[model samples]
Target: MDYSALRRRMVESQLRTNKITDDAVLDAMGEVPRELFVPRALKSIAYLDEDLQIAPGRYLMEPMVLGRLLHLAEVKASDQAMVIGCGNGYSAAVLARIANSVVAVESDAALAQKAQELLVDLGASNVNLARAPLTAGYPAKAPYDVILFDGAVQQIPDSIVGQLAVGGRLVAVLQADGPGRAILATRTEAGLSQRVVFDCSVPSLPGFAKAPSFVF
Candidate 1:
């Protein structure tokens, strides 16, 4: 299969047509071999305009949504980044091209192992795969310049937000209510400042459900 040609088509059709504009983002997405991240049976459809399931409850995020969120995050070359729920490590590979270094955290043992292998094979030297609970952001390397969620979440836990360096940006699909919305949250001097960047549809990362509310 002509994966390279298919990737180009994806960039022009799925991405550019959908309003993904950042050059760094465009280049990384265009360069990454997405087909390598999915099961071989699904490789032909890996670049389809939807999230490909890697596990029962987790998915490799849809390309357009991922692209848009990263574009909103404005990842810089010198920044340290973290990818939460980094299924198959595709997001980390793309971030590795842009960010100086990336620490990708995954909770599922099988997925984490597969991601680590693929990353190593790709020579993603700056990307480190760590197996840990997704909700508890890797604090050992806290104060990251950028943090990205590879899936949707009902809310950003204070603990995870605390990992971002002041002035750092974290982006994710926040589906707290109604339809999902892409959010760009910046760790600020005062506190975390977040705003809706756009609307999106992304499967939830395991363990990010909002806390239950009490009623009278």
Candidate 2:
């Protein structure tokens, strides 16, 4: 199979048509062999126009959704980025090309190992893999210029938000009980401000959903 051709088709058909205009994102997606990130059984369908579940409850976000989120974040070449719940590290691989440095945090040990292997195999030298809880975020490398959640979350916890630099941006899919909406959050003098970017549903990463309420 010609992964190069499939990648081009994904960029042109899935990403470009959906308003993913960032040249760096386009180039990185086109170059990174997405098939390598999924289970071998699913490699042939890696470029499908939807999310692929690599684990029981984790997913590799759809190409278009990922591209749109990255575009909305406006990741800069000099930015220090962080990816929360970076399962398999596909997003981190793509981001390693655009950001000067990336710290990818994952809670699952299996997923973390897979991510580390893939990132190193792909020569994503700038990505620092952190094995930790998804909801907790990696505060060891706090003050990142950009933060991205690789999956949907019910809310952006302050624990994660505080890690962003004084003037940083965060992107993620926000969903509670229905469809998810991609959102971009920015930290300012007062507090973090967020705006919905688009509507899209991707699988929720482990530990990001809202805790169950006690019913009397």
Candidate 1 on 164-214: residue-level lDDT in tens?
999999998888779999989888789888898788887888898987999
Model 1 pairs whose backbones collide: none
Q: Write the per-residue lDDT of candidate 2 for residues 88-180, one digit (tens) a residue.
A: 899999999999999999988999999999999999999999998888888888899999999998988889999999789999999997789
Task: Give me the displacement of residue 107 in model 2, in angstroms.
Answer: 0.9
- How high is the lDDT of residue 142 in model 1? 83
For each candidate in the order shown, give its overall lDDT on alpha carbons. 0.91, 0.92
**Per-model TM values vs. the true structure:** 0.97, 0.97
Which 10-residue span in candidate 1 carries the lowest summed lDDT? 197-206
Give me candidate 2's TM-score against the actual structure. Answer: 0.97
